[model samples]
Target: MGQHLTIVDHPLVKHKLTLMRKVDTSTASFRQLLREISLLLAYEVTRDLELTSVTIQTPLQPMEAPILEGKKLALVSILRAGNGLLDGILELIPAARVGFVGMYRDPETLQPVEYYSKLPNLLEERMTIVVDPMLATGNSSVAAIDLVKKKGAKNIIFLCLLAAPEGVARMKEAHPDVPIVTAALDECLNDHGYIVPGLGDAGDRIFGTK
Candidate 1:
C-alpha cells in the first residue's frame, strides 16, 4: 500500500513462484525455487545500494568501475523458513554479515515469543535485510523488527516470498520506515490466519513436513 513496498512482478519471478506454489512440488523443488526466487528478489531489493568507483583491469584495458560502497550489509534471517531465502541472498552478497532471529507462536495466545536472536557488530551502521518466507499475520514480522530496532538498526528492509494484505498493512502501521519486498500478495488470511490460496505453511513445505 505504501511506496516502500515493492511487489516484484518480474516474469521470471512469477514463473518460479508459480512452481513453488504448486501442491505437488517436492521439498527439493521447493528449496530450489526458494533459492532462485530469493536471488531474483535480492537483485531488485539491492538496486539502490550505494556504489563507489574502483580501479580495475578490463579485458581490453584498465578502467575504474563502480562497486558497492558504504558499510557491509547484514542479513537477518527469521529462522527456519527465512533460512531458505537467506541462503540465496548470501550467495549473492557473501561479504554481508549474517544474523538470526527465531520466534515461535504460543499455542493458546497465538502470539509470537522469541526463542533466539543474534546480530552483527555495528548493526546500526549497516544496511540490514531481514528475510522471512511468508508474511501471514505480520505479528512475528513486527516483533522481529522490534528486536532489530532495539539493536539500533535504522535502515531495515523486510523480504518475504509471499504476503497477505493484512500483514502488509500491519507492518506499515508498526514500522513505516522499513520497506518490504515480496514476490506475491495474496487474497486474504483464512480462519486460522494462514494466507488463503497461499502455498501451505512455508516452513513445513520447505522442510517436507505435514
Candidate 2:
C-alpha cells in the first residue's frame, strides 16, 4: 500500500468494526457503528487540510484562530454502500458540499458501470473525498475518481471502511496521487471479487436487505 494507504488502527474503530462484522449484528447497530467509524476515519482523512489563521475575540482577548482555507471540501459518495459511510462523515463535516456517483458492478466481469453522477460545482476549487464502505476490486473507485478528476478535481482522497490488497493495487496503478484511508486492509479478495473476512455485503447489511 505504501504511503498512499493509511490504516486507522484506533482501538475504538476496530472494536466497532468487529461488531459490524458479526452476522448477527442488527441493521440499526451496523448502521450506527459504520457512522461512528466513519467519523474516526474522517478525522484521519482530513488531518492534513490546509489551515489559515483568522483573528477571533475570546473571553480572554483577541487571538489568532486556525480555520480551514479555501472553499468547503466536497464529499462524493459512491452510492448505496457509500451512503453508509457518508451518513457518518456527514455528521462530522455537515458543512461540506455533498455529491453522489451511482455505479454498480457487472456480476460477470466485476467492472464498474456508471448510471448516475451529480457532483458539486467548482471541483477545481475544493478537495474531493470519495467515500465507499468497501474497496474490493476497486474498479468502481477508479472509475469514480476518473470522473471526479475530469470534472477538474485536483485534490482528491479515497476513503473506505475496508480495503483489499487487489483494490489497493488497482488504485495505486490508476491514481498514485490520491491517498486512501481505511479502517483495515484485509486479506486478498475472493474469486467473486469480495474482500475476505469482510463484513459481508456492506450495502445489504446497512440497508437490511438479503
Candidate 3:
C-alpha cells in the first residue's frame, strides 16, 4: 500500500484480529483483544512521525536525543467503539491530547449524523489521529474527518481495527490526503453494510450492547 493506506500485518495483530472475529469470543475477551490489538496498530499508525533531536547529557556523556517533533498528538476517537482503541493507545502515548466525535446512522436514510463533537484546540499544530474500530460503511469515518478538517486539522490519520473494501474505497475518494492504518482489510461489505468474514458490530461487541 502507498502512503494513503497501511494494513498492519504483524503476526500478533493478525492473531488478535482472528480471535476478535470469532463469534464465541466473550465480551470481556473481545474487549481485551481489541485493547491489545490497538497497541500494535498504534505503532504502525505513528511509524512516520517526524523526529527532531535535542541535546541532552547522558549519565556518561552529552548526546543529541531524538524526540518527537511538533506538539503532542491529538487523538480523536469516533465515539463509543473508538474509545476501546483510544484507551489502549493512551497507555502508550500518555501525553497525547484526546478528542471525541459522535455520529449515529439515521435508520431511514442510512446516513451518518453527528450528534456530538468535542475537539482539542490548535489542531493545525499537532498530528491528529482518528480512531474507530470498524470501517464498514465509511460514512461516519468520513463525516468525522470532515469536521476535524474544518477545525483546521490538516495532518490527520485514520486508525481502525478492521476495514471493508467498500469503506476503504469511500474514504480514499473522500479524503485521499489522510493516511489510513487498519489491522486487516476484510473481503467486502455485506448487503447490510457489515464486513464479510469480519468481526460483528464493533460498538456492540466492545460495549456488550445490542
Candidate with the greatest lDDT versus the true structure: 2
Candidate 3: tens digits of C-alpha lDDT, residues 1-210? 257879997999989998999999999999999889999999888888899999999999999999999899999999888999999999889999999999987766668999999999999999999999989889999999999999999999999998989999999999999889999899998778888988888999989999
Which clashing pairs does model 2 show?
A: none
From the highest lDDT down, the ranking of the candidates is: 2, 3, 1
**Deviation in Å, model 3, residue 205 alpha carbon:** 1.0
Q: Report lDDT (CA) for all predictions.
A: 0.92, 0.94, 0.92
* Candidate 1 lowest-lDDT run of ten: 103-112
Candidates sorted by TM-score, descending order?
2, 3, 1
Model 3 residue 197 lDDT?
Answer: 84
Error of 1 at 188 (Å): 0.8
TM-score of each: 0.95, 0.97, 0.97
In candidate 2, what residue range of length 10 has the lowest lDDT sum? Answer: 1-10
Candidate 1 Cα deviation (angstroms), residue 87: 0.8
- Measured on C-alpha atoms, candidate 1 has an lDDT of 0.92
